[model samples]
Target: MKELAYLNKFFFKYKWQLLPGVLFVIISNFFAVLPAQIIRIAFDLVNENIALYRLFNGFDKQSLILDIFGSSLLLFGGLVIVIALIRGLFLFFMRQTIILTSRHIEFDLKNEIYNQYQKLSLAFYRRNNTGDLMNRVTEDVSRVRMYVGPAIMYTINTSVLFVLIIIAMLSVNVKLALYCLAPLPLLAITIYYVNSIINHKSEKIQRRLSTLSSFVQETFSGIRVVKSYVRENNIRDGFAKESEAYKSESLDLVKVQAFFFPTMLLMVGLSTIITIYIGGLQVMNGKISSGNIAEFIVYVNQLTFPVTSLGWVTSLVQRAAASQKRINQFLKTKPEIINPNPNPLKVNGAISFQNVSFTYPDTGIKALKNVSFEIKEGELLAIIGRTGSGKSTIANLVMRMYDVDEGEIKIDHTNIKYLNLEDYRSQTGFVPQEVFLFSDTIARNIAFGQDQLDMQKVEKAAKDAAVYKNIIAFDKKFETFIGERGITLSGGQKQRVSIARAIIKSPQILIFDDCLSAVDTKTEEEILNSLGNVMKGKTSILIAHRVSTIKNADKIIVLDNGEIVEHGTHHLLMNKKGVYFELYEKQLLEEQQELS
Candidate 1:
């Protein structure tokens, strides 16, 4: 499979472990074939065969009995005992290596997927669900490990076992060996049909499983909204429907497995019967001795187990194939932004968009069309717009989140595409609209963006964001661990912490994507004031929905339908009798009326 080829390097990495595992299997099979020949020799010796009696004289009946019932059997049983012990020992190590190999692959796959996620543009997340992506990272990767590890081992072992049995059987009686193998072709055909059904059903099961995982994640995340809106029953019913689909699909896979294994056993039984009947006739007709017929029967069953193992191995393969397709898709995704020329741009807080046009990847419609803006050093510009008017797109472009389809964007007069993405991003700080905090101490979260520690700077940033008092109120102070998604804090508190994170970066340019939306207007004003002093001599882009928030900007740009409709100083825009004036007037009236 083209998709499976991606795992070639990983398989080669652990060949040391696999090599010993292969050797142990060979050794086990070698001893396994010896016993059948030994039994034939014993049969010959009992019938007054002088050669076998002379050959086995040292370990006679007394010695064999003592070895079995006393101590002499140990020598006679040496091959069997050593084979079992070596097989068991190697099996234990093999299991350990398998687990380690699976975990190692899992770790690499997760890291690769995560790093790709980081490199991808924001449009990628816009097109994919948060929950669905989580499923790919966790559930899909585990499935690949299961397939590559145990399934691979069993497939190899089974093939080897079958080959060794056939060789042993032919050495005793070629005609009977051929008869024993007659049922195998038919069995192969049946397994082919059964595996096809399993493959089809397994893909369906995996799809339903992803949907089920997504539904549970989405419902739990929105549990508050569901409860407040009295939609618990609706969500519960939806989850139940998804869960039932997953159950039904998994049952379909099991249905194929249920039939496949039993059919395999039936085929094995038929082969054994054929070998015994045909070999029985040869012995009676004096074509072969009874001892040879007995040896043939034992080898026939040895061959049967590998055949049965095919069914189990097939099931694991199908599950893996489905998972591999998803991972391959992730690996093949192309980032929206790439370095056509790898050069580092030295940033000085000035940015320009020259007749830029951009569109979201999954949608044909433009999010920012014919947009041009210039931000000079030490200037604060506010962006105000209605809900879908490309306010966030402008901020994304400044950070090179998505490259413009037409025209160019530059930082400090250098084209952003030529710059190394890591170096370019290092010069900028963006505080997103939705605040996301990790489950760590406040101090650590604030300093998360930087590589080195600076506790004093972190304390100063927290104070500047106006959350120092709140942090100190906790008994643990800056060391307090916020629970998942900052569940321990209020909405406004989370926003402040995120602002503190941006402040700690002290980047050349800062873009706050409506980061002040949650706090009260008074707190908003205080934080903005603090930002102005801290961000002096640096470029800042403030995005907000409130008129009071951006009235003091050196310039304010009004956006509508992915186009810039107005641009001027706040006061100048208010006197233009355009869209900006209407918004300001409407907001003023609403505020004045609220006072009444």
Candidate 2:
């Protein structure tokens, strides 16, 4: 019950659907108890030599006996059949309404979980694995639905039937009713121990299953690497270990259930034995009639069956509680990044970083320290540095993937924090060093951000990125489907496709984060030449390692060890004989050696 507290809002939202379903459950249980009463009446008729027709009308004994073989027996059989049919009808409605409501609730919950995932920050995803999250949305959600459906239905049915059957037994004989209920306290005590063990084991089983799922997902996603390294046997051994742990936990849960269910049945059987032994003696002593003893036995069986099945119902409830707790913990996490400004000024891509310092969460090392730079509107600024020199960090900051720890980033002389995040991001196009493409047609990938595809713009952007010739070389042309993560495309082709995607947006600012590293020198030159006209009067930031790539920029900044070491154009940096000069000299020697 404590585990189910999180579902209170869902219950309120779907009350209309659940209310009628509950009423049907009560009605169904009432009819289900009727057959026992009807059987008792038949037993009384036989014991007293009384005809059923005599009860309806005051007829003589002889005529009543004569009619027993005629219409009286038929009336008794027909009454039983009618009651059985009505009970079946109520049972159908009860299950249909409740099960459907549970399905609707499941649908709503899955969507809500997905929406939460979208709102969560990238740092949250970095901390969790894909398989664990997938299991929560699929398997855990199904478990929760069981509580709203079968658990709720059976709980109501058992409770209502228990009260009704107890009252019915009391009417037949009060002493027997008290005797039959005596074992209930012991049964409840046993169930408490069983439920506690089950709840603990069920939570363990779910977590172990999640661990197994994560292992499988990660293994398959990195299958190429595993095969390349000849680590198939090692991976198989790891998977087997996870699988064995899952199996052991599942069997433990099964063992608990095996002991629990039969214990409940034993309690029920004990109660039935007591009823028969005591009720028979009472009948022989002439305190109660034989028919009354039979009625008491039938009511006792009805009560005991539900009690015996309570173990199974409690298992479902414990599982749902465990699953709901996991889900609630995920939903309760708040994303660090959010839209702070209700109304924000528009951006024109004039970026300024003033005394900015940043450190990634969970890593004490600073990524950037006191980094300061500015790019005026329509200026072409190029950043060059060795690996881990905060080149990409600058791009990440400009894109607002993370906020600065100190100082502020401004666009168009207004703080970026005071600008609408979505609107500001819309005006900029980013092409990361590692390009990612969806499994879709080439044209769709190029026009990824647009609501509607403009084939003309798509083709023009492809042409500008210098990939149009290769695209038409395919049999399907732009309509060809690429494999997952663009597996079918070469590195250069994927990079060009990413460039096309950015170019088609016609953004006020364009960022090329070493995106041309994979292409040949000739292709790189062609792309730069094609992009010259597109970049005119637009703020462009190029982060590159090759000196040839950024030598022509209006301004070049060289970074080393999280700090800017040099700032100047290509010729000025060469004459200054600094870090940029050394890099240029090394690259020039490599090219000259290649020519020789």
Candidate 3:
């Protein structure tokens, strides 16, 4: 419940509905308890009149007694029916106000959690799996809703009804009232201990479900990899193992819940038994009338349901508390990456890295050591490096996907950290080595950079990336529906489509990080030729392992171990005969042998 207190704001938000709902519960219980009092008066009326009818002992006296009985039955029975109808009407309003408000709260809570997910940095995602994230927003929120809706409603209904019944019972016979309610204290003590067990088991069950969900999500996402390796049986076995663990935990929770209703029923039974024995003795001793005994029995019966439902309501609150704790923890996470500048210093794309160094946060690998470079406006800078030589790291840094661990990066000599992150990213075009596209029409994917689709711009970008021919070859052309990650297209086609997506942005800063690796040398040349026109007034950085891809660059930097080993134009680097020369010679020989 302490964790659930985080939702106090929502109660305040919808207080109007809840206040009226509480009033309805009170009104409904008033109508409900009034009928028992009416039954008591009718019983006493008939019992007192029986002696009068017997005293006269005549046919006319019998007729008068019959009339009296008939009138009492009609009046009291009709009142009982009318009261029930009124109670039912208020109950309907209760659900409409309270239950509907709970749904509204659910909607607000889910959106808050989703917004928090979007606000968190990539580092948060790296720490938590997609399954746990999904569960907090979906399953956990549902559990909390149970507390907001049914649990709160029943608790209110029970408390009001119980108080009314107790007041009525004491007005009849104080001694009898105290005796009948003696078992309730013991019932309360028992529930106090049982709730702790339920809470513990519920937490374990939720944790296990998160694990099971993660395993399933990962398995389905990589089904292709499993099939390719012919490991379907192994995957099945792994799923079975995880499923069994989930089942065992769920059963443990169910076992605890299984004891609740019966225990509640046993307590109800004890109260009923006490009411009969004590109430009957009071009537015989002339301490209360027979009608009073009947009224006490009816009051005990009225209490049966509200008392029994306590078991269910308690469990809901406990489970909701556990769930809200998880959701609160998720919401409380502070992102490592936040915008330092709300109003950005406008960028003109002249970028500089003065004595920059960086390390990968997740892997703890030092990716760069005192590395530096400069790219002025309208200049093309190419970086050629082997795999794992921090090639992509530079592209990431330029996009500000991460900040440097040490040293300074600047745009037009202004600190890069001072730029508004959203504005900076919006002005940059980036295509990573691994291409990704949504499951959507090719036209929409190409125009994803803009809020509205522009077919003319889409076609132009496709031509610039040299993917227009492949797109039109399909039966649906630009309207083609690609599968997830654009799986319907070939590797080279996916890369080219990704490039089209970037080109359509028309950004001031463009980064192509080994994106041309999948396409053939001829297509690569075609794209580079078109890009030469597009890059006329923009700062561009190209990361590649192939010397031929970057040979015509205005300048090239060669990296071997997270540091620049050589840098110059293609000819100068070749003349130097260093790492760049060795790589170029090896690739050139491989090409000649293939041609021969």
TM-score of 3: 0.95
| Full candidate order by TM-score, most accurate first | 3, 2, 1
- TM-score per candidate: 0.92, 0.93, 0.95
Question: For each candidate, C-alpha RMSD in Å?
Answer: 3.7, 3.1, 1.9
| lDDT digits (tens) for residues 511-551 of candidate 2 | 99999999988999999999998899889999999999988
| Candidate 2 lDDT score at position 241 | 95
The candidate with the higher TM-score, 1 or 3, is: 3
Candidate 3, residues 174-288, lDDT tens digits: the string is 9988987887898899789889988887888889888888988888878779999999999899889988998998888788778877887787788778878888888888888
lDDT of 2: 0.87
lDDT of 2 at 182: 86
Better candidate by lDDT, 1 or 2: 2
Q: How many backbone clashes does candidate 2 have?
A: 0
Whose TM-score is greatest here?
3
Query: What's the candidate order when arranged by decreasing lDDT?
Result: 3, 2, 1
| Ranking 2 against 3 by lDDT, winner | 3
For model 2 the local lDDT of residue 385 reads 92
